[model samples]
Target: MSAVTIRAARPEDAGTVLELTRALARFIKAEDWFLATLADVERDCFGEAPRYEAWLAEVKGASAGLATLFPTYSTFKAKPCLFVDSLYVDETARGYGVGKVLMRHICQLAVERGCVRVDLNVLNWNPARSFYTGLGMQETGELGMTITGPAMRSLAGLD
Candidate 1:
């Protein structure tokens, strides 16, 4: 096993991050669901007043995985939380502790940012359930919901 390093993702990393995102969508059988482009990633995550933050993981100088997240407030918990938008470890990097390394990095990051918890959404069928549980993450049992595209427009009276 070689040293694994996690670094803040830069605009130039948009392409690789986008590639990993495609891989993740395909792995979850939602290959056509993503409509984002590298420009979107670069603009939203690297532009002025960035909306999100990301970390790129590398093992022995090779891309290993990525973790993208944002800070949120937990009204109920009365503390800040780190909301993980995505955490994708390449299949080839599985069983090599890449996921664990990325997760630990997020944990330490949350602490440094004064966050009391971390939140993320995992597909029900994703096999990483055990991995997350092993890290002490548990299902919150809260139903997740969202409105997008036409639905979002209609809800906001923009349609």
Candidate 2:
């Protein structure tokens, strides 16, 4: 396994980050929804009022993986939580501890921000579930539901 270094992502990393995200979408069988481009990543992660924060994993000074986190509210906990919006490791870099290093840094950031917990959703078919479980993340056993597109439009009376 190669040594993996994790650090906060910069605008310059947008291109590689988009590539890794697409690769991850392919791995999770959701390539159809992998529509992000370098411009989008750069704007969303580094523009004014940034929507999220990202961490990148590098091996021998080359990007090997990345993770994006969004700030979320936990009403019950009455505090903020960190939601791992996306995580990806390059195919060639899997099993080299890149993913773990990225996750550790995210977790450390969550702690530093005084977040009550860190949360993420994993695909049922993804083998990384075990890795998260090993890191003390437990299944909530609660079904997730979402309303997007037209449903959201109708709810908001915009349609």
Report the number of the highest-TM-score candidate: 1
Cα displacement (Å) at residue 64, model 2:
1.0
Note the Cα lDDT for every prediction shown: 0.90, 0.87
Global lDDT of model 2: 0.87
lDDT of 2 by residue, 1-66 (tens): 568888888888878878878888888988987778888888999888799888888998988888
Poorly placed runs, candidate 1 (over 4 Å) = none
Cα deviation in Å at residue 96, candidate 1? 0.7
Residue-level lDDT for 6 in candidate 2: 88
Each model's total of backbone clashes? 0, 0
After superposition, which runs of candidate 2 have C-alpha atoms over 4 Å from their true positions? none
